[model samples]
Target chain A: MLFVENRELVVPGRLLAEGDYFAGEGTFLEGGKIFSAVIGLAEIREKSISVISLQGRYIPRRGDRVIGIVTDTHPFGWILDLNSPYTGNLMVSELVGRKVDVFREDIGKFLRIGDAVLAEVREVDERWRVQLTASERGMGRIRGGRLVEISPAKVPRVIGRKGSMLKVLEETSGCRLEVGLNGRILIRGRDLKKVNAVVEAILLIEREAHLSGLTDRIKAKLEREG
Target chain B: MAEAKPEKLLVDGRRLDGRRPDELRPLRIKAGILKRADGSAYIELGKNKILAAVYGPKEMHPRHLQQADVAVLRCRYNMAPFSVEERKRPGPDRRSMEISKVIREALEPVLFLHLYPRAVIDVFIEILQADAGTRTAGITAASVALADAGVPMRDLVAGISVGKVDGTVVLDLMKEEDQWGEADMPVAVMPRRKCITLLQMDGNFTPQEFRQALDLAFKGVEQIYEAQKEALKEKYLPSLEEGR
Candidate 1:
């Protein structure tokens, strides 16, 4: 029953009462009287009302791997842009398990700006800054390849169920495909035609991510077009 | 106000393209037009086209502002440089900011922000054309997008513009009227409540003239609202049957 003031029902909740204002989502009512703004639809379930509000951009979560670009470097960590409004930081300590000898001046030699890296969004600190780590294998500076940026929300769809989509893209394009959880995709190939083909495939995946049987259809398209 | 000398009428007593006052230009709306956005729609009103995307009631982060009670509405209104006759500079400007603020307010009354406290809902409206009433068009487009996204709302909000041109009140003013008209008023309202969530008027208007203009806008809004609902129903009704 959650709704916006003049939009459609976004969330299905319950109808609480008839009113002119919306009282946020999860609003409580007693004696059949609404006590909040009726901005969204009022869902009446047993004894409570829920309001559905608008949607926001995606944020990184724990255990989520993402593709990020190095934005800045500091003694302790390197700042990375996850293509989100918020940037994440990767600590040098997290990069290596064992402490290694390194001077402050030499930190830049290890990781420089614009170097695309794969990492995990560990946690958001109290200040809401994202912290990342790239200690795992298959997660590090992306080697020579073409990069494509897609909507972060489409990443899950592009990855498909259990890495199936990536497998298909790699097989068809004849390129090594690496999808960062943060929505950065890297297609590694020497042939320009193959690289362009892979990019087109990824874009197609992004554009048609919502429909069922998308992977199979995309495979067919690639087989025919490639 | 120093009146800019009336440039010879583009058409005798007719708007450019020859439409009369109170006449609506062709309108076409398509919902669920974008794949990545949770809900998206493209709207073409006369020569003006706009796309709107709606995303979330997910998790409210930053921990500090997280209200267990409501969601935040973050609206960004942008116009592509190619949207207008003259290329607009890319990025937010004073005009765009004002439109964004107005649109946010227009949508705020409809969203159940308290439900996802500390969480944020982002509505991005992109103008692909700029004939006139882009703000109203953007609002109308966003309303359909929210529906397409499945965001719950009490009712559909409709937006329309009214202006005074040559001492005459007109509905759905075009670009010329907007530039030379004595007043331009854009309103966003929840047709069900008959209440306005967004209202802005630029230019002079006598009390009677203002009332007349508002009435004209409301009439135009009813027509626009019907169009919005019909477009959404046409697009989503099929999904409903499939679910059944």
Candidate 2:
């Protein structure tokens, strides 16, 4: 039985369910009861109950796309700051997709220390050592784009239903948005006004993601502002 | 406390502040108010105004201080020079340093520190206005800030002070009561488990009176806990209900 209503904001230690439900992320099972482990909105599915936390530091997970800045370099790879508690290691092989002799070749020719890289988490161990790969299409170094950071939890809302909101944003504002799961969004457009409009729209989504009918409101806002 | 007692602290059944002995002063709490901090809260109780900011579960600095198994909880409790009636000196005094230590311990139990090993969680409390129960108020605000920052915890901590004044156990003592009452005790409790994370007493209390004061403090903390929950809901959940 559900003790708290679905989509209701629940604080930590709140009893979310009591019987015959599996606990998911942001929830813990004690004896026969499930309790929320963060301040977030609760969700109860067919057999699982979980909470969607509204605020938190991002934890790196495998297969997650991330945008990171190179902070330090090791003999094997460059450490990328994932805007999370843990950093990601982007090896020269992963970035270039080829093996190189460290002594014979300078890896700096491919990526600089301060360059931004669009990458994906290849692996993460129990100790939070993150391995990043940027050999995929449209990955690797980011050249020039306005970068905006939002709450990581709100990234899904910014993308919206099957990329519907993203499509609308691209079409109306005439801009392409490369959103990272780590909460960094890169915007590229010829028109400065349209790019700024997309930034505003992203901020609005972050603030009002909990509300409904946000897509239409955003469309209206873009039309009015554009 | 003042050396001399007032002729009457309770008129009929109400205390000097026009409240029952068990009533708490008005509280205003808001979470996630800061832009830079990971989590932050602003609280106003009676005439006391406080701000709390939480940072981390991030990497521990000083390389050597990182605990291999758990995150370290560090807290700082500071009062502005102009916070009280008299202008106080700035920086960490011995009293502020002691309060900072106890506040850290008060919040450590609820946090799931082991989840983020080799990290540190910093809780900073700044008192903008002084009241009688600043330490309790600081703890109350810091816990909310921690939750706002998305730190996982067993439960939120709620705090209050109960004191004996005019032979009566009054809840949430006022500044005047804190100074003039016969005894003042501040208590912080983890509301879910009903465990005392912080307990400090001064002045005097008989065995029976101490138990009664604890009961009143528990009652006061219950109310504070409710407010803390509502404060968080009001920030994120109210919009969803409003859409309907």
Candidate 3:
């Protein structure tokens, strides 16, 4: 039988019980004749229970795009802040097709501090440090645009199914929009009003992306205002 | 927090749903709310609900890091998997760590650590429903838990978020405002000292806009601090009179 190890479920407290099936997070297993700490509700899986622990920096996976800000520059690469404990290094060679010799003091000419960019994750070391590369078109420094960051977990919702949400933003606001899978969005438009409108729309999407019938609502709003 | 639709537009310069810029959506706080914890409180600010618990001023095991002069603060900030629109994998993420660290620091200054030497003070904050200002709300609720635990503190810390949207600085942005607004600045303040314990900003803002946002945050903090004090007083004052 499942029983609560701790107190009521209204507060931020732990719940536990010895059982074969893992109850998982956000659940309380409560009943009779139970032992405390027998099983934690968070991080539990089928027939397995895992303790919650915090360590290591965030690492990026292949096909995962992230928002990065250039923090430091080196002779061959630039250091990037990926909104995680780990810092990513983008090699200069990845930016250009051919190896171009440059003066050591002139690295800042290419990228400087506080410059936001979009990059794809290439590799992650065992230590959780990320190595990034920007070797493809539509993947590099964001130019003449506005950038917005949201929770990384919300990235998929922002993109929507088969690029449907993105299509709406582009078609209505007439902005060239790029969304990195890592929760960064870039919106570029000559009209400040349109740019502002698109940014607001994206933010709304991030907040309410879980709800259904969102596209039609956003489309109608944009058409009426834009 | 749910998304904001346009039909929800402005009514008399207020939100489409009729909320003022400085007005809170709705707030609820309950103390002594958990039986298992030494002290606990559940706080709901708008759609963001967080529960905070104080577990111990107990013996430190492994016996290695115990200090002779003060108690160590152990804090864990977590988001439930179903707290957001998408189900998150159950674990601590980088954002949670950063928030936990700040919360630990915020409590350290307020708590009288020397009172519980060689022991540990454990604070666990969990986000039940996330809107825009989870951290701020967490910090506020944790203070209530600490107070309920009878932990001595100089003053309560209050947190709030201020931002610029459409060239207008607003106080206590909803989730949608935070996501779409041009800038968001969350601050944790000590009302007694008028000093800030935690501050973080994202998005674009001019220096002037930053100052304006901070001003708005200070205003918001004052209002929240009063509510916190009221909640604490309501919880403990009657009990204190009974003890006497």
Best by TM-score: 2
Better of 1 and 3 by TM-score: 1
Off by over 4 Å in 1: A1-57, A100-105, A171-175, A189-197, A221-226, B1-25, B28-104, B107-135, B138-157, B162-185, B190-195, B201-219, B226-244
Give the C-alpha miss distance for residue A194 in model 1, angstroms. 5.2
Candidate 3 structure, TM-score to reference? 0.49
Docking class of 3: incorrect
**Model 3 lDDT tens row, B1-244:** 3555444333466863467766666777776688667667888888998999986665566568777678789989999998988898899989899989988997777666775566677899999889889988899888778766645455677888887666577787787777766788888887756778889889888888888878888888878777776675565445223322
Proportion of native contacts kept per candidate: 0.03, 0.60, 0.00
Q: Model 1, residue A43: displacement in angstroms?
A: 19
lDDT winner, 1 or 2? 2
Report model 2's TM-score to 2 decimal places: 0.93
Q: Give the 10-residue window scoring lowest on summed lDDT in candidate 1 chain B.
A: B235-244
Calculate the i-RMS of every candidate, to one decimal place.
7.8, 1.5, 16.8
Per-candidate TM vs. native? 0.60, 0.93, 0.49
C-alpha positional error of residue B169 in candidate 3 after TM-score superposition, expressed in Å:
1.0
**TM-score, candidate number 1:** 0.60
Q: Write the per-residue lDDT of candidate 3 for residues A1-226, one digit (tens) a residue.
A: 2333222111122224465655443332345211211111134344543322111112366657887899888878798887543467888877654575765435566677898878888887654447888878877777778888764445665676898888988899898887876567888999889898888888777555444577777888777878
CAPRI tier of model 1: incorrect
Residue range B1-244, candidate 2, lDDT tens digits: 2346667888898887899999999999998899899999999999999999999877677869988778889999999999987888999999999999989989999998888877789999999999889999999999999999999887899989999988899999888888888999999999988999999999899999999999999999999999998888877776777666
